[model samples]
Target: MRKKRRYIIVMATCILCFFGIIYFIVPKILFYTQMYDNRINVAIKNATDIHDLLEEAIHCIEKRQYYSAIKLYQKVVQDYPYHKKTEGAQHAIGSCYEWAGNYKKAKEAYNIFMKKYPDSKLAEICRQHVVELDNPIYRKVNDAMVDKPEQLDKIIKKCQKIVNNSSGQKKTDAMLKMGECYFLKKEYLMAIEIYQEIISNYPDYSRIREVEQMIGVCQGLLGNYGKR
Candidate 1:
């Protein structure tokens, strides 16, 4: 049964990766990013050992309900310690934390996973994650922004460097962060312009609706400020 369950999990991971945005899977729940295709849903549902907690956790992740998903994944680990999917559950807790922008907690969770599953196939991946998170540049911009939010210009510059260096979804993410910095700085016109660029350049961005909403809000605010 364990072997069968492991095989199912591995196969599902492969399918999800091939079908979804492949560049980054660990940071986002794999199947969740692909618009929740019915086949993925069916596969998860059919995986009997992963019935409720893991399945629901994936749903929460799809909805960007990171904390909720973290709880569900933690439940899977705590309540079913010996379950075939426990390693995945443990790893997912870190992924949820990373997606939620809690890099410190994500690193801690990955470290715990490495310790618990030293010989598991995911251990090497966890080690890579640990190395990635330890890099100050990866989290510095966000962390500094949080520490000195009034320094919006500095943060935007940092985000711009990220945008300049990255491509595809990574660039989209950096652009969104830069737009957010503008919005927070009350530079409504600038925020709207950035958001518009995102709409134009990255039509397939997953958070398109949210980006549109941000633009709308910026426009309304600009009008109120007599800048429109």
Candidate 2:
């Protein structure tokens, strides 16, 4: 799975580079950008070619060939945004990423749609999708945009949902995050308890080492270093 993810990352980079855009990632931040300002080259293709590509891409999408559809959609965006189905293509591009297991990229694509066609009928619908993507349980509460205590409480509730409703590795990751959330709020005792619960339940999970480190950190913060 990791290799496949890395391969897709490499391919995504090459595809974007082929058309003069770049995708960069920062481990701790959300940023997505692509530029196609003065480089739109419609003069090289006749009108009929754009139409054909649009139809073909739509066909590919219906066949669940989203990668090819995305390439076709990118071509239309770069060569012919004036195409009648450009907005639909943009929406489809976002859907492709969502289908392919990268909600972050899907959000970025949907964001592009919102920026490019804010008044479109799909704009509000896409914004709702973005909110769903940012539900905070999928990541940790530390990654949430909480500038206040109340906001932190909201994040805690969402993270707790993941702990309660999920199972397997998903539940484990969320449980660990639940501890991290408490730790962030300076609730060291609760954080320590959560970490200990994880250790007891998931002794053989892959992230046990990280969980142990978090447990130690929480203990240290509570001034219990000598107890260990």
Could you give the C-alpha RMSD of every candidate to the true structure, in order shown?
A: 21.7, 22.0
Colliding residue pairs in candidate 1: none
Tens-digit lDDT string for candidate 2 (1-228): 999999999999988876553234442223311221111223224336665665555445444455666777787788777876577667768766654556788899999999999987667657866886687653343335223445666766877898789889888877766776676677878988888888898887666655665565456456554132
TM-score for each predicted model, relative to the true structure: 0.42, 0.38
lDDT of candidate 1 over 1-228, digit per residue (tens): 999999999999998888675557644765555544444445444545545656566556545567777877776787789987687678878867866779889989989998999987667666766776788875676455544567778778877998989898778877988887776666777888999999998988765655765665466444432122
lDDT of 1: 0.71
Query: Least lDDT summed over 10 consecutive residues: which range in candidate 1?
Result: 219-228
Backbone-clash count (model 1): 0
Clashes of each: 0, 0
List lDDT for all candidates, in order.
0.71, 0.65
